[model samples]
Target: MALPSAVKVFLLTMNRSLGHVRQVEARPLPPRNELQQSVLVKTFEELFAELRQKAAERPEGSGTVAALDKGVHFIGKKVVEEAAESWMAAEHEGRERTAEEISQLLYQAQCLMIASGLDLEDVYRHL
Candidate 1:
């Protein structure tokens, strides 16, 4: 049973005795610096800070609805403004601009969730 020359070559490459072993350059793993610049983390921090402030502004367990409504309303306003910016970007600039605007819009929406006493993690978990 004669094997093809390619098979013999492949077998030789797999063998530890082969002097023609492939050299794999050991590259340093990518740094986690990108996470420091993550928009998601930044947005979460901003949203949570505002949420805490709004919570602190709460009048000692009185009128939770009012607080929630105020927060939601403010977030809704931000969303609308962001949406407008996105639309303008889409019309005037390009996809890159529009994507940036949309990212801002998502951040605003996340703020709304926080303000409304909702956890973004919960949404992520459910999804």
Candidate 2:
């Protein structure tokens, strides 16, 4: 069936107007609050416990400071795993996926800090 010339022109005009309206309303996005201090604390505690176990398992290292370094490798392993998960999430779509992946990454990082006898407060203090 052949369409009327007037109808075709009206449809084209409307499409053009909608494109312009969208362009005019386009703006930069604000930074999202993906993580917060309270969330960090909770995740940090969990990671810390894991780190403590790793450290206790390897008590061969001398003194407090020296022992801290022994578990660094273990923490490193966890961090690497978290990084891979985060990368996977980033490759996929959706805010929730990224959030969960980032949460894991943060948790592993906290584990590393805890292995070194550090805490969330220490990071905040340094910041």
Candidate 3:
């Protein structure tokens, strides 16, 4: 089955942000014993900081800037769409795919939060 145009666009934007283009090849996973140690570490706090900077700077060709320029409603819709995609990926695809979708969901949700003038501290206070 073919993906929706919006999904394709989102993937393209994400790929560009990651310095990737058109096709990406999958590399073999690490040995089971090394899996835990080999995992790439990241934090939403770091991501939010970057997004906040992007919002302030509006760098050329930045996906974050593009999303912010489109305003909160568009980012909100993307967050909702990504959430559904994440659920679908978990149900139909396996762990790796689910992780990818969840990453997208988090990015979009963060974009929404930034556009709404909220930050990690605001969310943490509520939780």
The CA lDDT of each predicted structure is 0.65, 0.62, 0.82
lDDT of 3 by residue, 1-127 (tens): 5555544533222344558565433444446567657776557888888888889988999989998999989999999999999978976998899999999999998999988988788899988
Ranking by lDDT: 3, 1, 2
State how far residue 31 of model 3 sits from its true place (Å): 18
Per-candidate TM vs. native? 0.43, 0.43, 0.69
lDDT tens digits by residue: candidate 1, 1-127? 5545544433223335555555433334234576556533444556566555755676666443354666787768878999999979976989799978997887677666767667767677887
- Stretches of candidate 1 off by over 4 Å are 1-70
Q: Write the per-residue lDDT of candidate 2 for residues 48-127, one digit (tens) a residue.
A: 66656665675565343353665779668878988988877865756689878888778667656866667678888987
lDDT, model 3, position 3: 51
lDDT of 1 at 56: 67
Which regions of candidate 3 are displaced past 4 Å?
Answer: 1-37
Candidate with maximal lDDT: 3
Better of 2 and 3 by TM-score: 3
Q: Candidate 2's C-alpha lDDT?
A: 0.62
